[model samples]
Target: MFVSKLFGGRASDTFITRNSGLISHLIPGDQVLADRGFTITDVLPPGVTLAIPAFTRGCKELPEHEVTRTRRLANVRIHVERAIRRLKGFKILSNIIPGRIQHVDDIVTICAGLCNLQPQLIREEIEGKASDLDEDEHIDEQQEGDEYSWDMAEDIEGNHLF
Candidate 1:
């Protein structure tokens, strides 16, 4: 779901508080694909999964498994980034809508709606790449016992050493 409400540059972790209403709508086991900036896992509805890239802290490189997972995530996430780009394409949002502008919120919402109606931002070429990665994911799932995908809080699960 696309959110067009203006949140004036608060930390991404504050997303839970900002979008509290959204939480009630989420069902258990829902998969939320987000970037590393979203660190509000604690506030997520129970059983809701948050998928983000693996962090490479202290280590020179991420594990081979992590690298593959990250690649798969990036393949899906590019579309989200492109959609944001489309929203920002509107001049009002690309530049600052002045405080004096009447109904600025409505204008922003309208722009977002219009942007959504436009064709998918990413071209068809990458669609095949995403599908190919999906097939690889099935193969990986069969090979790896339980490590199906990248989860931001995997470390907190107390299974991974690094």
Candidate 2:
């Protein structure tokens, strides 16, 4: 199920994430997959993790493990981007109706429902191929076991650490 909230265009992603009540629904150990723009690590409830692509900072290149993790994250993030694209496809969402501003939440919920009624976003065959790649890479058991963790931390300077 999809949960959504309507916020003004000027609202920051971190603000919306913290105030939208979405965090309340998450439990300890829940991992939130998000884009680099979502810098709400400090606001996340205790034990809840956030995962985003690794930043190279001033380094010449990211380590091999970071590269692999980033590739996996990007592959999964593609589906999320596609879902947003589908949501935007609705003409009602293209232009705001001043008169229906109060009902924007309902409209978004209905549109999300309609999108859910469509075919599965990722097919089983494609998923199998991804697993095949992982096997070919000979991923370690420890990394495989922590696949769902996606632990991310922020340093004292607010820079994200993988």
Candidate 3:
């Protein structure tokens, strides 16, 4: 799943996603779960869906269904974040990659492979139960008022910048 090259730290998420070659590997009916920062709907192939949290632009609060979807998405993202944390456990990845390194991608791929070979992060029983949890059940223990920043850039049309 490592489809993109090692990009600089300043690269935008959408820009990296566009050049990642990840879309080519996906087929129709596939859904790409992403963070709100990635506004890649325009570049997605036909029949592919992008799932991100709903934006509460003009509303005081998100609708019930949107809240449910956002919670579920956040629950799923926890595992993804854990996997990334495991990948970062490697000493080489913990530090900033030197600019002179020409084969950084290969090294990262090898490290990822090594991480994959380790024990599964989530046990099957727990994973199954996690999926079965009710939509209203709060998985994340984040405090109230501690929300992600909504100060995102927008295009001339008032749409979120990609």
Candidate 4:
């Protein structure tokens, strides 16, 4: 899914142009979920569906319905974000890659391949204590004047006590 290499200064929308060959794999029935910066819906393949969050255009808050929709979109979008985060975990992609670096493409590809061989960035099912809020429960108990509580512990909101 990695697309073409372009200058870092160029807008991502610029890469969606017909000459960029980035959308060659897209077909009429394809569905594209993209961020707001990708405003190239008109250039998409015919019948393609593009899902993006609503824009506020300077308004302080989006409508409640738009907010809900945006939250849902963000939930799905998190997976893509996590994938990119994992890719960036590799030292090569974590930093600015110089254009003159030797075999830079190969390095990226190898890092991505290595990442794929590892466990998934996220799992569908929750398991054991990882899924439980045991620490929060312990904190709640400690808040009830327990002997184990410190004399000057701050609350979760950072409210300090003398």
Candidates' lDDT values, in order? 0.53, 0.62, 0.60, 0.49
Candidate ordering by lDDT (highest first):
2, 3, 1, 4
Positional deviation of 98 in candidate 4, in angstroms?
7.1
lDDT of 1 by residue, 38-157 (tens): 766777778777777898988999998788777766655644555555567677766565773666667777877776566544344333334344435422112222222221111112
Query: Which scores better on TM-score, 1 or 3?
Result: 3
Ranking 2 against 3 by TM-score, winner: 3
Give the per-residue lDDT digits (tens) of candidate 4, residues 1-162: 343444445555536444556566565555566667766677777766676778898999899877655555454454455555566767666664577366666777677676566554333232112213232232111112122211121212222211
Q: How would you encode candidate 2's per-residue C-alpha lDDT over 82-140 as one tens digit per residue?
A: 56666787899999789998989999999888776766555434433332446234322
| TM-score of model 3 (CA atoms) | 0.73
Screening candidate 4 with a backbone cut-off below 3 angstroms (N, C-alpha, C), the clashing residue pairs are none
* Root-mean-square deviation (CA) per prediction: 10.4, 9.4, 9.6, 14.3
Best-fitting candidate, scored by TM-score? 3
What is the overall TM-score of model 1 with all chains considered together? 0.64
lDDT (10s digit) by residue, model 3, range 1-162: 243678888988888888878767665655677767778889887877777778898899999977876776676556565556667778886664678388778778887787666665544443443436665664453322232111221211222221
Worst lDDT window (10 residues) for model 4? Answer: 153-162
Model 3: how far residue 89 lies from native, Å: 0.7
lDDT of 4 at 161: 11
Instruction: Name every residue pair that clashes in candidate 2.
Output: none
What overall lDDT, based on C-alpha atoms, would model 3 receive against the true structure?
Answer: 0.60
